[model samples]
Target: MASLAAGGVVIIGSKLIGGSWAMLFASGGFKVKHYDIEQEQIMNALENIRKELKRLEQADSLKGSLSAEQQPSLISGCSNITEAVEGAMHIQTLLPHQ
Candidate 1:
C-alpha cells in the first residue's frame, strides 16, 4: 500500500459504482479523487460513502486497516475531470455506455 501513497486514484462519475470504488480504494489507504459533472451528485456521493463506511465498520466488513472515519477522509470531490485526473496513478471511469 506504500505505492498507493505515492500516487492517488481518479474516479470519474459520482454514481453508485464510482462512489463504491472510491470507498474501496480509500479503505485500502489510497487517496481518491471523485469526479462528477453535477455538484449535487458529488455531495450525495460523499454522504453515501460516509454512511456506507459506518455500516461496513458495524458489520466488520471493511477492508484495510483504516477506520470508517479515516476512510472517507481520503476521498476528495472534484468537479473538473482534468483536475481529478492530474497526478492520479490510476483512473477508473463509471460512465454509462452510449
Candidate 2:
C-alpha cells in the first residue's frame, strides 16, 4: 500500500477534470478522496478512473511506479464534502462549464 502523506488529498468534483486530478495524486501514492454531492456521479467517476488507468497501463503510459492495479486503492469516493476535506493536504474545486 502507498504510504500516504499526513493530510492526504481531496478533490471536490467528480467530473472529467476532477477524475484526472485524482489520478495524478493517486499515481504519486497520495490517498485521494473524490467529493461530490451526487453519489451516482462519484460511482461513475470511480469506474472511469479504473478504466482510464488500465488503458494508460496497457499503453505503457501510466504514471508512478505502482501499476494501474495498485493505484485504485489510493482513491475513494465521498459524498460529504466536509468530511472529505478534513485534514486533506490539498483541496481542488472545479466549477461547472457554463
Candidate 3:
C-alpha cells in the first residue's frame, strides 16, 4: 500500500459522483473523507465504494496504483461537514440533480 498524502481530499454529498471522486482520490494514495448530511447515506456510500473497489481490482480496472484493499482503507465516511473539511487539501462537492 502506498503512503497516503497528508491533509488529503474531502468529497461532499456522498452521492454517486461524490463516491466516484472519493474512489479516484483514494486510488491516488489520498485519504478521502466522504461527507453527507445523513449518516445512513454516508454509510451506504462507503459500503458501495468498498465493494466496487474490490470488483474493479479483480477486473484490473481500478484507477491509479492503490489496490482495492488499500483504497478502502484510505476512504472514510464523515457526517460532520466541518470535520470532513478540516485539514483537507482538496474539497469537491457533488449534489444530486433535481
Candidate 4:
C-alpha cells in the first residue's frame, strides 16, 4: 500500500512488528504514534523500534534522507487511545482480523 506522505498516526498492538511497521512509516517522513494497551508492550515496542532504526542506519535505508539526529524524532509512544489518535490525519489500525 502507498504511504501517507502528509504524515499521521499508527495504532499498534503487542508485537514488535507493530513498532517495526511504525518505524517504516516514520522513516517515510510520517509522524507515527504507537499504542499498546499494556504498558510493558509499549516499552518493548519503543525499544524494538530503536533497534530497527539502528539497523536501518547501519544498512542506510531510512527515508527522506534524514541525518542520524533526525531519525529518532519521527516517532513517539502514546499511553491512551485519545492521545494516539489526536492530530493524526490518518489512522492505521494494526489489529489482526477476527
CA lDDT, every prediction? 0.89, 0.89, 0.87, 0.71
Instruction: Report the candidate with higher TM-score, 2 versus 4.
Output: 2
Q: Write the per-residue lDDT of candidate 4 for residues 1-98, one digit (tens) a residue.
A: 33555657666673756776777676667777878888888778777777767777889876656654565577778878887887788776667679
The Cα error of candidate 2 at residue 43, in Å, is: 0.2
Give the least accurate 10-residue stretch of model 2, judged by summed lDDT: 1-10
Output the better candidate (1/4) by TM-score. 1
Candidate 3 per-residue C-alpha lDDT over 41-61 given as tens digits, one digit per residue, 9 for 90 to 100: 999999999999999989989
lDDT of 2 by residue, 41-62 (tens): 9999999999999999999999
Can you give the TM-score per candidate against the true fold?
A: 0.93, 0.91, 0.89, 0.77
| Selected candidate, larger TM-score, 3 vs 4 | 3
- Per-residue lDDT value at 20 in model 4: 61
The collision pairs in model 1 are none
Q: Where is model 4 more than 4 Å wrong at Cα?
A: 1-7
Lowest summed-lDDT stretch of 10 residues in model 4?
1-10
Which parts of model 3 have CA positions greater than 4 angstroms off? 1-5
